[model samples]
Target: MQKSKSFAKYADAEAFRAAMEDDVRRGRYHDPHQESRLFADVAVEWLHGKLDLKASTRSRYERELRVYVNPKWGAVPLRAITRNGIQQWVEGLTTGDYPAELPDGRSPRPLRPRSIRNIVKVVMGGVLEYAHDQRWIVENPIEKVTTPRSWIRTTTRCI
Candidate 1:
């Protein structure tokens, strides 16, 4: 049976059963044993292998991964990262209730929702895509997550 990346680590048995149901609905499943690598290891390999990114973009992604994503999810097995966990993590970013303190030499500050979205897109999105391609997980969990919506404000000028 194949497993999707949305299966959460430490999830209850019922969650696994639900995931199996989801797999049947999707017409595919995941092998839990296939996801043995730590997320950090896969992310680093992907970062080094991507020759298409501009130096600045690559640097920014690396920094974001190191300062934010890694500290929280790096040690997790790729298959064990669930959509709910990701959503909660994203919410934590906006609520200033992050799962872990930033790694050494990084400062915590109020991050705008847009910034948080971008970090998730660039770091988590990229890593999960790579993981999916490697068949480490059946689907990219990032695709199932919801980032904060962008809000726009307009001021009316009196005539």
Candidate 2:
């Protein structure tokens, strides 16, 4: 992870603190999309490292790639993923088809939507937003799918 230089060159104590506070007061916390958008791999790499996030956030990205992504189309090249394909992927999650790995390295039951939605909301959401900014695609795959505070549960199990 790289140190944030988004705020710099303020020598005073109170004034510097105030200016930092102002940036947060506005909705301008971090702008990851201000860089090049045509390169998908670069954006992915940056999302893994360049973004200044917490440990749990980084773990969420890993989960997004593993639980929600890799078992299906991860092997395919990034350019081959079309808009419709992305839509289908999101829909697939609703069916509890997500693969799972046991602690003993054996494959377990597929994950429910409740387990999958967090990765979709946090991890995949960031990737889609970054891809949109990079101009790698016309629009974000996860666009219009708002993140919820809590996922809905079903009678059978967690949904």
Candidate 3:
């Protein structure tokens, strides 16, 4: 058996080791250095690999990745994506100081909670779906990360 690697300034070594053991024993943890890929990478891979989404979906993910996920928590590995990060990312997108610049040279409007929630939905959905396919995770992380569902419905204005 190969030895498990450790990170400096990284907490929860034992827990990670345990999860790794589960991965290995369960036949899920391939690629010895899975630790190198961050949630951002996983998100991109998930978006492309797992989703049969449209261009709009891809664009939205690109925007969110560039604006929010990449800047804030891109360096953090997938194993380290806790509910706290998800919560903070959602808050940052909606109520917090998190907006990316637009082509018009202005910061895009901040995402509403619902919109952010949907993004979270897509992201987590993709993550867990992939996890399921890989047999690494049996449950979605949504239960762990509490998110507010957007109650906004349709609105139309036409001349």
Candidate 4:
């Protein structure tokens, strides 16, 4: 058998090595260097590869990407994001500085839960879904982040 490549992480060298052993044994070993594509790059690939979307829908998704997703996560690597970090970022979008401006010239207000949910689903969710399909990350972190809950109606009789 060929010698396994050696690499060093700042910490967790043994754990990382163990993980690599499993990957090698399974023929799933990926070069750590090539796996470092930034989220921004993945997002671009996703946008361009989405041949099924209507022009208007694609435009809307692109706008959402620029307005909501890119500013915060564009420079981050696909694997660097964590569930807790994503949750905190979503929470931040729920209040204070990131408020949406009213079209009627009123004071800016925090994004509505539905809007936040849509942003998460459409922009962040789409990019991560693409990344997951491409195997850039072992699993999509988007699945682990919680978006603000929106109201759902259940069928019931009213008096």
TM-score of 2: 0.50
**lDDT digits (tens) for residues 34-83 of candidate 3:** 64466666666776774577888778777766765566666676556666
List RMSD in Å for every model shown: 8.3, 12.7, 7.5, 5.8
Worst 10 residues of 2 by lDDT: 31-40
Task: Compare the candidates by lDDT and give the number of the best one.
Answer: 1
lDDT of each: 0.82, 0.55, 0.64, 0.75
Cα lDDT tens digits for candidate 1, 36-91: 77999999998988899999989988888887898889999887898889988888
Stretches > 4 Å off in candidate 1: 1-32, 99-107, 153-159
Tens-digit lDDT track of model 2 for 1-159: 354444454566557678768866874444334333333354366466646778877776665666556566545544555566655655656654445433467644444555656656556556666655555545565666633345565677666
Query: So what's the TM-score on candidate 4?
Result: 0.72
Q: Which segments of candidate 3 are over 4 A away from where they belong?
A: 1-32, 99-110, 128-142, 152-159
| Deviation (Å) of 11 in candidate 4 | 22
Show the colliding residue pairs in model 1: 1-30, 2-29, 2-30, 2-31, 3-29, 3-30
Per-model TM values vs. the true structure: 0.72, 0.50, 0.60, 0.72
The regions of model 2 sitting more than 4 angstroms off are: 1-43, 82-84, 99-114, 144-159
